[model samples]
Target: MPSQSKLLSITTWLLGLLTLVAMATQLTIHLRLNFSLVNFFSYFTNLANLLAALVLIATASLRLASRELSPALESARAVSAVNMAVVGIVFSVLLRNVDLGSLQPWVNVLLHYVMPVAVMLEWLLRPPRTRFTARHVGLCLVIPLVYLAYVLVRGAAISWYPYPFLNPAHAGGYGGVALYVAGIALVFWLVACLLLIVPKRRQVRNH
Candidate 1:
C-alpha cells in the first residue's frame, strides 16, 4: 500500500488536473461566445477554483520532491479550502437554479460541485501542517473582501455582475446587494472558523 504522503500526492494531482480541465473547457466555451475574458475570470467561482488548483498542484509537487511546503503556501492551502467551501455553499443555495447561459453542464458540475467538495474533503482529511491562528482566519477573508471590492467597482463601471445576487439591478438595488454581501461575509467567517477548529480537534484526538 502507498504511504499517506504518496496517496495525498496522487489525489492532489488528480484533483488539480481535473480542476484545470474544467476551467479550461469553461474558458473555451466563454471565448467561443465572445464573452469578456475579464468578466469570465472575475467570477469568484473561477478565481477560487483556480487558486485551489494551484495550491493542490503546488503542494503535490513539493511533497513528491520531498520538499516541505512553506508556511505561506500552507496558509494559502487553508484559505483556498475555506474559499472552496463558501463557493460550494453559495452556489448551491443562491445560484443553483439560475441560468448560466453559456456554461456547459459537465463543467458546471466540476466547478460548482465536484471541485468544491473535493477541496474541502482534502483539507479535512489532510489538514494544514501549520497551526492556524486568528491571523490565519483573517488571511482567509482577505481575498474574498478584495474580490467583493473588485466586483462592485467593476460592476459599477461595466453594469455587469457575475452573480445576480451581487448585481444591484437584479438584487433590487445597491442596498440589496449590500445585504447579500454582508450575508456572504458572515458565511466566509463561519466557514473559516470551522476549518480552523476542525484541524485542532483532529490533532487533539490523535494526541
Candidate 2:
C-alpha cells in the first residue's frame, strides 16, 4: 500500500503544477497583445482565485518542509480549491452572458471547474489515516467564513462585490448574498464530512 505521505506528496505536486500554470496563464493574458477569454470573470473573482491557488501551492511546501498538518488538514485544503473554483465559475458565467469572447468562456470553465474537479477527485480517493468526523467539517468552514467576512467588509466600503448578487446595490442585495453563501457553506461542510465517512475501498473501487 502507498503511504499517506506519498499520496499527499503526489497530490501536492500536481496542485503545485496547476497553480503555476494558472499564474502563468493569467500573467500571459495580462502582458500579451492578444485578447482572450481571460476577461470572463470579474477581476475580484480572479484575484480571489489567484490567492486560493497560491494557498494550494503553499500547502504543498508546508507538507514538504514539516509534514505538520494531518491528512485531514490536507482534506480541509481541498475545500478551499473547491470554493474558489465554484466562485470563479459563477463569476465567469455572468461575464459569458454579457457577450465576452468565446475563448474566455472556455478557458474560464476549464480552469475554474475542470482542473479543480480533476485534482479534487484524486484527493477524494486517497485512503484516510483517520475517519471523517465533525471536526473535519468545522475546519472546512473556517477559512471560507473568514474570506467571506473580509469580502463583506470590503464591499461595504467600496460598494463592490465579486458577483452582482453579492453587491449591496443589487436587487437581492447583500442580505440575499449572505444567505446564499451560508447555504453553500453548509452544503460544503456536510459534503466534506460525508467524504470522510465513505470507506476507502468503496471510493477507490468506483474509480
Candidate 3:
C-alpha cells in the first residue's frame, strides 16, 4: 500500500511537470508572437490552461494519504494548487473578453483579487504538515528560477517574450519588466514562506 501511494505521488508530480511545461511553452510562443492572435483558443489563452493543469496536478498530489508522505511535499502541493487555480480562472476570464475597459472595475476585482484571496484563505486554513524541510524549499526556489531564466534567455534569442510583463518594449522598459518580474518572484517567495511557516504554528498550538 505504501508503494502504491508513492507511485501515486510520483504520478502527480509528473503530471504537474507536464502541465507547467505546456503552459510555459505556450506563454513563450504567444509572447514571441506579440499577441498576434486574438482568438480565445489561441496562444494568448494558453496560460490559463497551463494554470488549470497545474492546479489539477497539485490537487492530486496534495490528496495523497500515506504515512510516508512528507509534510513539505503536502504543503507545497496544496499551496501550488490554490495559486494555480486562481491564476487559471482569472486568465480564462480575461481571454474570453478582451474589452476590459468596458466592464466594471469590480469585474477585474473578481478575476484578480477575489479569486486569489479565496484560494489563499483555503490554503492558509488547511495547511499541510508532512515531509517538508529546508532542502525541499531550496529545490522549489531553484526549479522556478531555472525555468524563468531559461525561458527569458530563450525569448531573448528569438526576440520574443513569454508574457507581457516580460516585454520591455511594451512595458515601461526592460527595467520596468525586470521590476515586475521581481515583484512576482517576491510573491512566490512569500507564498512559500507562508506554506512553510504556518503549519509549524498549527502543530504547536494543537500540541
Candidate 4:
C-alpha cells in the first residue's frame, strides 16, 4: 500500500492540474463570449480558484522536492485551503444567481464545488504539521479584506461588480452591501476557524 503522505501528494497534485485545466478551458470559452481578461480576473470566484490551484501545485511541488515541509509552505496551504472553503460556501449560499452560461456543467462544478471540497478534504486528511492560533485566524482575513476593498472601489467607480450582492446598483446600495459583506465576513472567519481544527489523523486506512 502507498504511504498516506504519498497518496495525499498524488491526489493534491492531480487536483491542482485538473483545476488549472478546467479554469483555462472555461476562460477560453468565456473570453470568446465577449469577456475581457480584466473582467474575468476581477471575479472573486476566479481569483479564489486560481489561488487554490496555485497553492495546491506548490504543496505538491514541495513534497516532490523534499520530504520535510517548511513552515511557510504549510502556512500558505492553510490560507489557500481556507480561501477555497469560502469560495464554495459563498457561491452556494450567496451568489446563486451569477450564471456561468459559458461554462460546461462539469467544469462549472469542478471550479465552484469540487475543487473547494477537495482542498478542504486534503487539508483535513493530510494536514501539514503546524499549530495555528487565533492570530493566524485573524491574519487569514487580510487577503479577503483587500479583495473586498478592491472590488468595492472598482465597482463603485465603473458600475460593475462581480456578484449581485456586492454591486451597488443591484446589491441594495451601500447599506445593503455592508450587510452582505459583514455576513460573508462572519461566515469566512467561522469557516476559517473550522478548517483550522484539523484532527490528528493516525491511520490512512481509517481515514
Candidate 3 residue pairs in clash (backbone atoms < 3 Å): 70-130, 70-131, 71-130, 71-131, 72-131, 72-132
Error of 4 at 84 (Å): 1.0
lDDT of 3 by residue, 55-140 (tens): 54555555564334355446455545434443544355433354443223543454344445544554565566664567655644
Best by TM-score: 1
TM of each candidate vs. truth: 0.94, 0.61, 0.52, 0.89
- Expressed as tens digits, the lDDT of each residue in 1-207 for candidate 4 is 257777788788898999889889878987888877887888777888888888888887777666666777777778888888888888898765667667688887898889989988888876767767787788778888898999899887888887888886677789999999998889779987876766323333345
Q: What is the C-alpha RMSD of each candidate to the true structure, in Å?
A: 1.6, 6.3, 8.6, 3.4
lDDT of model 2, residue 170: 67
Predictions ranked by TM-score, top down?
Answer: 1, 4, 2, 3
Worst 10 residues of 3 by lDDT: 38-47
Residue range 103-181, candidate 1, lDDT tens digits: 8899899889998898888888777768788999999999999999999999999898999999998999999999999
Q: For model 2, how does the per-residue alpha-carbon lDDT over 114-183 read when each residue is reduced to its tens digit?
A: 5556445545654444454576667667766776677678678767555555666763866788776776
Better of 1 and 4 by lDDT: 1
Count of backbone clashes, every candidate in sequence = 0, 1, 6, 0
Give the winner by lDDT: 2 or 3.
2
Clashes of 4: 0
